[model samples]
Target: MIEGFTSSLAEVNGTRLHYVAGGQGDPVVLLPGWPRTWYQFHKIIPLLAQRYRVIAVDLRGMGDSDSPLPGTTRRPWPAIYTS
Candidate 1:
């Protein structure tokens, strides 16, 4: 919940992905490392947003994004995020 930034959810690849976006210009996507959520970039988002359209996403099963069903392991990551 950083100032000037807004969060939203998008349905992609049959899953809902959560993201926080702000600013304008060329796009910049931020993905947190393992065991972390978009909040990991909360401190740097505003700075980056000053010069680019920053999008910090909560990967599936993290933060506000939906979790996959147990034993599910066939979904392709790139397809889910790109499409």
Candidate 2:
């Protein structure tokens, strides 16, 4: 919710993932640890946005992202981050 940051939902691996992006320059992805969400970086997101394009994501089963049920097969998730 920072001034310049924009939040969005993306369909990745058949899951709806939530993320916030802002600023410019090289991309910087922020992945929260277990039981956490992108809000964890609320304080620093704006600061880092000053120098880089910051992207904070809410991983599967966390935050605004859709949680996949157990035993379900999913495409590789890392591919979304790598490219």
Candidate 3:
């Protein structure tokens, strides 16, 4: 898991998403299991950050992310860069 930073929120598909970003070489995205947050990646983030810009995101309704309202649209493609 990655470390050294707190999970932050980002707007994605019109919803606030929880995430943590670090490192400097290249952009890398990491996702955790259900009920888990970006914090789950804490142990690995620092090591990865040394070589790439690591980003771990909390899935909707989990962790620091805004509680997802019922019936919210599905957004399972965080791996695809939107911005």
RMSD to true structure for each model, in Å: 1.4, 2.4, 3.4
lDDT of 3 by residue, 1-83 (tens): 33455557788666688788878888999888988887787777888888998889877778877775566545444532264
lDDT: the better of candidates 1 and 3: 1
lDDT of candidates 1 onward, in order: 0.88, 0.87, 0.73
Scored by lDDT, the top model is 1
lDDT of 2 by residue, 1-83 (tens): 78988989998756789999999999999999989999999999988989999999998889999887566536466754443
How well is each residue in 1-83 modelled by candidate 1, as lDDT tens digits? 99888989999877899999999999999998867899999888889989999999999899999887665557666766777
Instruction: Score every model by TM-score.
Output: 0.90, 0.85, 0.75
Q: In model 1, which runs have C-alpha deviations exceeding 4 angstroms?
A: none
Superposed Cα deviation of residue 74, candidate 3 (Å) = 6.5
Looking at model 3, the pairs that clash are 1-41, 1-42, 1-43, 1-44, 1-45, 2-41, 2-42, 2-44, 2-45
Better of 1 and 3 by TM-score: 1
TM-score of 2: 0.85
